[model samples]
Target: MRRSLPVDAAPPVAVGRGEAYENMRCDVCGSGERDEELLLCDGCDRGRHIFCLRPIAARVPTGPWFCPACAPRSKPVKRFPMTQTKIIDFFRIQKGAEDVEAEKCGIFQDVKKRRKRPLVMHKKRRRILPYVPTEDKVQRLKQMASLATAMTSATMKFSNELTYMPGMAGRSSNQARLEEGGMQILPKEDKETIELCRTMQKRGECPPLLVVFDSREGFTVQADADIKDMTFIAEYTGDVDFLENRVNDDCDSIMTLLLTEDPSKRLVICPDKRGNISRFINGINNHTLDGKKKQNIKCVRYDIDGESHVLLVACRDIACGEKLYYDYNGYEHEYPTHHFI
Candidate 1:
């Protein structure tokens, strides 16, 4: 059923501004036109009027356009070279099957008897049954259910720091602080904040702790010390061209952070491949096992004097030692498995 067009017998003519135009009649309609409006075929030098072509045009095309005579013809494609014996054997098998089916139907006898009833070929009916779960599949489901129960219990135990208070339905303390500060918060410490604080604490010279990393809960940014929201967590800096080349080559496993939504921009942070402690921050699924909603942080675009930055902002109050998590896909329920590290 497959067919292929033959390769062009003639080489394509290079079309450029300085090519010489030949004076000739329209090969399609056999009409001659001396006007500059006619388009000359790059292959045969045949002239064609703007209106005479199948697709009537208003102007010359940007690229080379060939005439019908100059267009390549299609040739029947043979995938494999066939022997004469193989061809004869194929036809013989087909003819034999047809003859046997015809004889079994007895079309000649029905016509001789002057029967007018249409011939009907009754086909055997087949019933399809629903798939029954295997014993292994059922056992797997039970194991998954048990795992979900355990994870739910563990999550609740670790999340006790986020105590619920009346009248604060959804707003966290950090969110309230952010609202009071006009959505922008000044960084209290520079890039060496965590390292300096750790070093100072080791020398018994530091203020109350602001954040800590728990083995089970990852890094938790606390709001106990009037810490402002929209804090600069950490950043991954790399060559924009190198990141683009990696993505172009389908090496997207490292693309963990989306710095910009605009394609024209070239700012993508890939912390999964190389990053600081912030990369250890986990992401929440659409729904937890306990059926409670849980997104704590958000990635926001922050511009600093013409340079772009992606900042992690606390959308709700995060308690001390509470795990930090954000929706990786921006939307709930839609999980992109391939993009996950």
Candidate 2:
């Protein structure tokens, strides 16, 4: 017989091949070899297909001898979640949970957060008023302010009283003269000036609008204009005694219009003898001006005594129930007048 292998020593199992009959460890779950039907796994060297080994091995490929645990894990995972998606979803869920927790706390946190936010608003400034006098009583504070407007300008023509003859062309000519000579309602630049004044007044500072009018037109008197020999005629009321004081002290003779109540229920003030300069301060008071029909006009007059006092005229005619323009001088403006819903 050919030289036989020794009983004690069959060829030593190659280190790479593993010992003969020494079962290969299962790659799946590291379970020890239990089945030997499938030949050694190429990867794990176990004697069974990987499907037989681990909990998830049923999902792994069979036939190819691979450790069951290893096979399932090695299969390419499908449907991996995107990083951004995962993060957003996680945060959303976290927020929901927190909301639930907040609800359980018995305090309405959402409502509380809303309430905690302060109601903020933008408030337009109220113009500071020329002091309402408590002493000397002039009248027609509103009319005075308008008459003192620097923007209203007029051109006057010298015509004798004969020119005012009623029913004569003289009267018509006088009418034309009045139209041309008397203060022609000057185009008002007041909106801009008022806006600027409001901006300044907001800071608790007084900013006056100084304007210059051409006296060549009608007798022009601005708020800051100098007064010399002008006679100011204003209307009056025995009622509202408090107003008398304001006129005496706070009213400036040059800048104020005297208010007078007439039987017609209208307030009339005259800057000069010429009716052209008469200011209807209390048109609204008498219902000559309807406040409901238009909101811009109102009856307001500050009474004071002086030849220089100018009657304030309404930019628009007025009616009753309108807010008087007495406070046109200037007032304090507060920030955030209202809260946003």
Best by TM-score: 1
For candidate 2, lDDT tens digit of each residue in 1-341?
A: 01112235454345755554355544434555444323354364445432333221211222233344445555321321334344233222122333433332333343346458777786733221221111211222232223333112221121111112232122121121222122222112322222332232222222111222222221222232211111121222111112233322211111222222322221112122222222212111122243223323222232121111122323442232333222222111211111100
lDDT value, residue 282 of candidate 2: 19
Residue range 224-309, candidate 1, lDDT tens digits: 23223443333322222323434433222232222323333333443322233234445554444431255566755432323333
- Cα deviation at 332, candidate 1, in Å, is 12
TM-score against truth, every candidate: 0.30, 0.16
Q: What is the lDDT of candidate 2?
A: 0.26
| Residue 127 accuracy (lDDT) in model 2 | 24
Ten-residue region with minimum lDDT total, candidate 2: 332-341
Off by over 4 Å in 2: 1-122, 126-272, 275-295, 299-341
Model 1 gets an lDDT of 0.36
lDDT of candidates 1 onward, in order: 0.36, 0.26
